[model samples]
Target: MPGLDIREIVRAANDRWNAAFNSGDAAAVAALYTSDGTVLPPDHAVVKGTAAIADFWAGFISAGVKDHDIELLDAQDGGDMAYSSGKWWATGLGEDGKALRFEGTIVTIFRRQPDGSWKTCLHTWN
Candidate 1:
């Protein structure tokens, strides 16, 4: 069995992410990650560090991105490491009149930080 439950972590992370993105607060979203965290975007190279992560997400914020109705597909826990897959749709002017649907997967390696918060040490996406 996994050492820590990942469902709650994923829920919290997604909540913060959705809130930050909808509010166009890139910095706040980035703050959810560790200082040396890693984010792998679909069309771009790996983004390392919190500053770079913020920069990478800047486009979405500037384009008025909106995420809604996130349906969690699966969650697998492996001690301090876990992954989740889900389907989400974003509807906004940036995506035209059509909603942008994505079958996304996120694998996160969690680290027990000094402050006792489970921070993402590494993250990869499809």
Candidate 2:
């Protein structure tokens, strides 16, 4: 791990997120966040804490969203915090039950856990 970089770290974190999300396990997705983690979803009210975040993700999963992906354009770490910014997208069911795509720029902040792993602290996208 001596040569591992911030980009690699962010990618690994996001990979775990995608795995949890794709599997339709909201609890697993929430586990990727810090205990007080929060999500600022587009055009929606802010969601905080692991439980609320789990329900938030459950809403999305129930709405038929899948194939969520992240493309880390930039990543940096300092002290006990790190952040990544880039493209994110997913497909979901529209009102007509047809495939609808959502894509946008996003930034995610993560905190270093006591065990040296990173957990999401904040996320916002537009």
Model 1 quality (TM-score):
0.75
Candidate 2 residue-wise lDDT, 40-72, digit = tens = 998899999999999999999998999999998
**Candidate 1 per-residue C-alpha lDDT over 1-126 given as tens digits, one digit per residue, 9 for 90 to 100:** 134467777767667777887777888878878899898777888899989988877877676566643556676666555666666656556335565544455556666566556666676666
Question: Clashes in model 2: which pairs?
Answer: none
On lDDT, the leading prediction is 2
lDDT of 2 at 94: 87
RMSD of each candidate relative to the true structure: 3.5, 1.0
Write down the TM-score of every candidate: 0.75, 0.96
Candidate 2, run of 10 with poorest lDDT: 1-10
